[model samples]
Target: MAEVHTVYVPRDTTACSLGAEAIAQQLGRHLAMHSPDCRLVRNGSRGAFWLEPLLEVETEQGRLAYGPVTPEQLPDLLAAGLLAGTTEHPLYLGPVDDIPWLRRQQRLTFARAGVTDPLSIEDYRTHGGFVGLKKALSMTPQALVDEVKASGLRGRGGAAFPAGIKWQTVLDAPADNPGNPQSGRKFIVCNADEGDSGTFADRLVMEADPYMLIEGMIIAGLAVGADYGFIYLRSEYPLAHQVLQEAITRAEQAGWLGADMQGSGRDFQLEVRLGAGAYICGEETSLLDSLEGKRGMVRAKPPLPALKGAFGQPTVVNNVLTLAAVPWIIDQGGQAYANHGQGRSLGTMPFQLAGNIERGGLVELAFGPTLRELVEDFGGGTRSGRPMQAIQVGGPLGAYLPAAQWDTSLDYEAFAEAGAVLGHGGVVVFDDTVDMAQQARFAMEFCMVESCGKCTPCRIGSVRGVEVIDRIIADDNRAAQLDLLAELCDTMEFGSLCAMGGMTPNPVRSAVEHFPDAFGVTPESSAGAA
Candidate 1:
């Protein structure tokens, strides 16, 4: 085994894009020529995409960090004695965890994020991994659910529904179902679609600590009396998909998964299923539809996926983060996890700070943090380094929050009060360069293009929406067009079946209300209103 004190670089897509690999190759030559005692490891990313070509040295003080450190600058960094802790590289920051962006996060699901060689089971076990499964095996299935109930964990899959309650529902299903608890026929599925444009937390977790997701699924299966699991991940993330499959294989062969998991007398099996790039399939029912080999269309609510899911049997459908966080909660006890966040939104949230934002990466935080602190302080404003004009919280279905509402806390209920959703905890920043009218129209256009075409309001309403925005933008019948646009938004708000139709107007309506001048409408056109 190599010494803990080693030089490491991230090899995730973002780092690779910035040539971290080439830097590693160069550093390997330098290390062989100079310090034979030094070891270097190419590891997965820390999810800090912007800090690519990042270098870390295990220092006596802690794991000291430096970033965007290219091979071109290696001579200086080496001469400065990075290994001896005498380096003052501008990128050198003491302890990766001490960084405000990474430190503030509660990090149950992200416990192993930047610290370990992601694919190594030994690294995982050394960090207190698999404790949840060992603890779960000692309890009855019903008792396991009760422990989760005490943990105050809500689904992180855009819906804040309680995870324990969902598990209870599956356990309550009749025992007469086709398969016995040990038969491996019943299953749990992780929804890794994560189609939200600005969000990448789930993908990062899978790429970094895929076994956490697998372990979480095994715990879900144990608690809910299921014997098998499937993770329906998106195809766009080939790296995540590949990493997850390899993790599953490793878990199975090591007896961490599959029948007789960890010698607990429990039978559980897991696998990965890839999605063909349909955003609509992120919806739980729609995900099940796609999993069943059918078109991905949103199904009406009433019988939630927890009750009747995946092949019409009782199933637990959870987001990757939601499931990934379970092992930590269970291992450390419920109260330790529950005490981290604000009321109603308990536990840490892996907020994906991206898009026009300056700090574009995963920032896990306690729930009470304000959106302003998240976007400005952690994100450091827009990528272009301009003052933020408008911000969209949640995904595209969310509202366009003006600068005035930036003080709102990042919680489900708090965001709901501002007429926004913390859907998937994605905050997309926009500078003054963004056109509000264009952004509004793009929301409806997204809905129109992605709509399953099952209903009228979303299908027909979206096409008309494009024309109305064009008219408003072109200054044709200005006031009348604005009023007409408002009317159409109202109809979409109340008339649509699912969020696709119902919430598509949120961005448009908020944009219109907050930035009226951006619409390019004038009072003179109001003369026709009479």
Candidate 2:
């Protein structure tokens, strides 16, 4: 009998979308007939999307990889000694870790992604999964909050607000549970409603390593004295929803969740609620409203979510990446995590590269790298193989950075200084064929379509913005239209209710300022508009 070997097939959304299921089925049937003893394991993607449906075979040396695999190629792969982990195959990518693309990433939060069977608790534990939660259980709540503060972790949901500060706010705010005065109810809401364009890290995290998020939320519950938690997930992520549900159930069964957390005498409960595809629900307040079965709309702040959130109780609302980073912070010590990046932007970010880029995938690196490095080095330039035009660093609402600004560091403050943002670490590249005018129009058009319609600026200003851009493009009173557009942007920026209206001008202004030619703004016309 031949020795049994383990074969890994990624079950991540990206992998499955690219036919990993078919590849897995093909491999399974082939293995049953030729090598019945071989074990097939479904794992999560390693964030190397260019190699989706990536297959790995465990050998005495290490896990050797073959990728972009298809069902049609299975017979040849098998014949080439794929079960024997042969390197002679053209698709063989050597040791998985040694692959330069995977090797260079600073994968802290995603340490276990793609490496373990996502549903297996034992696999998660074996690879140092619950170490942070265990360590967090031993510390005082304040101590844990202090550790997070020391780490300088910020909200990855675009605001870049310090996570530690928010945690401390929730920790200090008195829970407003009148019925249970002695043990008040505080809530931890994980904002998994990732609606930003060119962003999928949140979904990847949830589907690939559900337990990491679950463990992070549990630690947050402990840190802030929150007894209940809810993950407000977007409706598009059905796979993530299924995976999270299963992971939560397994967590409850394993004593990591439910009435008594690992017998520590602390109580924490968690549940997942689906969002109805409202882009505004990505906003924390709107998310809370949607979670409460109300129409998703932004709430005025001053009664911050920390003071009064879901159901009029103090709630700690954090983005998926923000919370998912907690367990690592607690286990490694805050300063250890802080030591990775420069300035106020501490630690690594899982930067998602998309849009007209070759080798597009997730690159987790420290915050100081320039956008050029990320786009050129890791992304391998534009997919069109043409001269690059614009680079949108943050999201749809983020600035359309011209080549001059591409050298700016990826830090939050640095990007702000350069009139750009590091919102959610989503870098979308565009080739020279892109029309900046159309792209700018799409920004307003998107705001118009996705706006919650609670505020006039976001709702009406966006509509006016689309009209003004069209007039300018048609060369109808170009200078005056440009001026009108600028003023409207100002009104939306200052008078609007939330970032939904305020940040809409970022892309519009950036396109006009950087690519004035595209907007039909000549030197004389620009001077007149100014």
Candidate 3:
């Protein structure tokens, strides 16, 4: 009799896009002929995307990795004793856990990612899944809220609002279900609409360790006295949609998500609602409108979502990463989670490195490392091997940071003090070849295209912004145009209804301030520069 071995090939979108499916098929045929007893497992990516289709083989020593493999290389890999987990193969990456890229930082929320079969309930449980939810069931709702608050967890979805405060608001807001005073009809909404450029953490969680998200959502539902939840997923993420829907069905069948969750008598029902590719729907209020089958548009605050949301009921609106962090807080205790980060930005941030980076992927670190460390140490500098000129933290609306600002700490307050944002933890790199003037123009153009047209500042102001930038670049009354651009940015920043219009000026102003030559003006001559 032969011992059964396991081979893991990532089925996540990144891996599949990089020919993981072809590699898997090639491996399957070879396995059947050579080692019939061995099993093939379709797992999630380890977030080291440069190494995808990263193949892992479980052995007595540890899980060994071989990566960036092509279908043509499969025969050579097998011939080099790949099935026996041989390090003799050039592609072998030693123990997966020992990789410097993965070993350096903390992985609380993503602890189980790329480790287990994403849809397997038994595998999920074996890897400490649902431990947080089980613990949450033993505690009172107030205690749960307090635990999250103590952890100092803030919204990971750009705004950085305290998650515990939002939870408390929904908890304190009386549940008004119309005819039934005791109906308790509050809702939990997970904003999975990851429309920001260079952001994929939300999609990764949904595709990799989906149960973590499901468990987190369940915990949120229990804490807020809500029996129903909806994950407002973006239409662009078809793979995430399929994985989440399947995970939900499996969780319900296993009693982790149904009316009687794990026999605890909790009645939380969850579903996924798709958004119509509108970037504005990433906003909580606009997401609610879309969830209710209306056009995606922003709603005025004061009647906050925590007070009246999702069909005129009190609601908890949090993004994927924010909710995904809950189970860890509950399972490990709030203070334990709080002990990881710096200042008010407690807990680890899964920073996504993209654009011109050499080793572009996810790097989850505590909130203290400078941008230089992330780009040079982890990212390995620019893919073009050229000098790095600027880095755009957060999304398109985030400020374009120059090399002078690279040493700034990654803390929320630190970034805020530097006139930038740590939005969604996306760090997009740019080489010296990048055109700052064109980049600034695209920021306004993007806003003009994506704005919901709900407010004058976002709709009309963005259009005017593009024209002003064009005139500035054309050198038509350069200083005067720059001054006018500054005034227009001031209007949009103060008068806009949301960050869409407000933050559009971030890149524009930063570019003009840092790289005046790109805008046809010298630093000494540029007027109204930040």
Candidate 4:
């Protein structure tokens, strides 16, 4: 009998796109012919995208890694003793953690992301999963809410609302259980419809370490006295949807997500519902509307989701990151998690290094890394090998910071002061060749396309914005056009119904402010100041 060996391969979407599935299948065949005793395991991505189809072998020393493996190299890799970690392959990445990209990350919410089998409840548990949920089961709902509150956690889904405060409303609000009117049903909803450009944190959690999210939601359900929870995932994430469903089923079978959980006497049910892929559904109100099978539109908010969300019941709406952070806060005391970062931005954030960056992937870190450090040091500059020009922090709707503003820190208040936002912790870089005017115009065009049309400022102002930016780019009535653009942005910012238009002005204004030449304005004339 051949000795048994364990092989690890990624099931992450990016890895799959780069042929991870094919590589896994081929690995099975290769081992069957060459070394049949090897058993393969499909795990989540290491967030080192450039090294996709990364293969790992569980040796006595540790899990040795190899990367970007292709079908043609399988036999050579095998012949070179790849599984035994003796191969001198150029793609070898040594031990996974030894990689600088993986080492630098603070990785709290994403600690188990690349290490665990996404659908394996057993794998999840063996790797420090459900400890939070276990702890929450013993604590009173108020105590659980207080723990999260003390953790200094704010919503990671752009709003930055205190999650404990949001959950408190659900804890205090009257549950509107139409099915059992007297019993009072509340809800926990995970806003997994992550539509932000350059942001994949939610998707990574859903597809890679889904149990972390499930555990977080379970804690949330327990804390709010909610009997039901839903993960509103976007249709674009077929892999995430599939894996999450599998994980949910497994959790239910193991008695982690059934009607009665962990013998806690509380009843809860978890489900994954697909969204229509509309960007507006990212907003909690629109997400609630979509969850109800209504058109994905933002509802007016005085009632707040905490008071009247999800079928008129008090609801706790949290994004993937916010929910995923709960288990960490529970396992490590809230204060332990709180002590890592600066100011109100306590704890780690999964910063997605995207766009023109050379070493693009996820970089989870404590708050306070300057934009320059992220783009220049961690990212290793641009993939084009050109001088990095602009850095777009947050998502598409975020402001584009110029070189002058590179020293800006990662704290939410710092970004707010700099006229930008750390929306969803996405960082997109641009080389010197990027045209700021066209990019600025795209901000308006994106708003016009994605606007829910709930108000005049967003629906009409976005259309007018495009026209003005075009004139600015063409130098046609450039002076008046600049003035009109500024005024139009202010209207959209102040009057828009939701962030679709309200925040679109951020990128547009930032680009116009920093790069006047792109809009055909001479910097010395003060006309660009508009």
TM-score of each: 0.93, 0.97, 0.98, 0.97
- Evaluate candidate 3 by giving its C-alpha RMSD to the native, one decimal: 1.7
lDDT of 2 by residue, 79-179 (tens): 88888888898899999999898898899988889999999999999998999999988999999999999999999999988988998999999875676
Pairs of colliding residues, candidate 4: none
- Name the runs in model 2 displaced over 4 angstroms: 1-4, 177-183, 528-530
Which segments of candidate 1 are over 4 A away from where they belong?
A: 1-5, 29-37, 79-86, 175-185, 522-530
Name the regions of candidate 4 deviating beyond 4 angstroms.
Answer: 1-4, 176-183
lDDT of each: 0.82, 0.91, 0.91, 0.87
Rank list by lDDT: 3, 2, 4, 1
For residues 114-141, what per-residue lDDT tens digits would candidate 1 score against the true structure? 7787788888899888888788888788
Which scores greater on lDDT, model 3 or model 4?
A: 3
Q: In terms of lDDT, which candidate is stronger, 1 or 2?
A: 2
For candidate 4, write residues 1-530 as lDDT tens digits: 12439888899889899888888888888788878778888989978886777888887767888887886777688777787775487877788878888888888888888898888888888989998888888989999998899899999999899888988888999775667553477889999989989999899998899989998998999899887899999999999989999888988898998877877677789989999869999988999999999998889988888878888888899999999999989888889889988999988888999999898888899998888888777889999999888999888789999999989898999999999999999999999999999999999999889888888999999999999999877778788888889999999999987888899999999998998878877856555455
